[model samples]
Target: MGSATVLTSSWFCVLAVLAVLGDAFLPFLPSGTLVVLAVLKTKETADAPFLLGLAVACASFLGDVLLLSLARRGAPFLRRRLARSPKTAASVRRVQRALENRTNRAAATVVIVARFVPGGRTVLDLAMGHLPERSRRFLHWSAVSAAVWAGYIVTLGWLNSHWFNTTWLSLAVSCAAATAISAAVARLVRRSRQLSVVAQLDEPVEAVEAA
Candidate 1:
């Protein structure tokens, strides 16, 4: 209702878009923190959080598309660089194989889940871009992931506001919580991959034993 609040909300939304978009390429940028700050700033403004969330989501989706396009255009060079690093190359190949083997639904699930894990989004996007056939599907799922991520992050900030009196405290607590969640998701993903590998290894042994 106030002019000051409106101006603050507008400025926060603009910063949120830049932070979210820039963080896609510059991993060091604290985009999540900025989102939380935005939530804190706009908490009193009617419908501000919804609009901010939508803006952040669109920015994230656009950033992902741009990153994927860059990766696709530089695929040959990226492949050559990866090839020089055997371990990294092998890891990328495994991800490609997994994507190729999975159903569209399952692969989309992976894309959605990867958005929660720190750094996972970048890696997966780059890997998906390297596979030209998979790029279109990646875009579709990226949009879903972006919206989900934006909502979840905004909710976290809003929830923190209920418990904390100060903006700095709310931002700090929310960011810490986000980091913890991301770490947990990364751990779960690693465990799932390990279990999958173990299952694959067991298949050959089971066949040998039966024969």
Candidate 2:
């Protein structure tokens, strides 16, 4: 068999397994890069594996949205535990301020766009959990954002499949690299958002003391 055929078959199997198992069992699977690589490989592989990409994307989108919904329903339980830890409360407060701002609609837009931004989804999900119970606006924006994210990643993967060139070693390395990159991005965004909130939180306190 030609190398491309072997590569194509192997990628199809791997993508299928990841779709079925990875998100639930392995948090670090780099599903985004896997999709990207799968699409990239389709240039020379078997029959443009776009269906696999779509399935994975839809699964991921559903998982994210479901998790967010669960978090929202379970907020009171979370808040009790979170409220006990000063650090947790502080983080929650930051997220709350961001979500409750006069430009909150804008913040929801960020949350939605962040879903496609590699590392932004997890943090945004957590932040969404802490928004006021009555804030349906955040939920609407989040669902729209999540849908956009799913379509964008799947489309990118389909378009870029020709670049994936599915070697086992290459796939392994790409997954690792994507995970690292996304984690680093998430950490930085969280820190920046936290700092911005801290600054905002201190402002009113400072104003009150001055008065």
Highest-scoring model, TM-score: 1
* TM-scores of all candidate predictions against the true structure: 0.81, 0.54
For 1-211, candidate 1 gives per-residue lDDT tens digits of: 6898879877887888898886665655788988999899889877877888899999999988886887788756555655565654555456777777777888887888877765556556666778899899889999999999999999999899889999999998999999999877766666685323212211101000100
Candidate 1 — which pairs collide? none
Clashes of each: 0, 6
Could you give candidate 2's per-residue lDDT for residues 1-211 as a string of tens digits?
5887767757664674364233422334556666655655554545545555546655655655554565578656444554554554454456565656637555654655455344344444545665656246655665576456445554655543334555554555555655565455445544665334322222111000000
Superposing every Cα of model 1 onto the true structure, what RMSD results?
9.4
lDDT agreement with native, every candidate: 0.74, 0.50
Give lDDT: candidate 2, residue 160. Answer: 39
Query: What is candidate 1's local distance difference test score?
Result: 0.74
What TM-score, to 2 decimals, does candidate 1 have?
Answer: 0.81
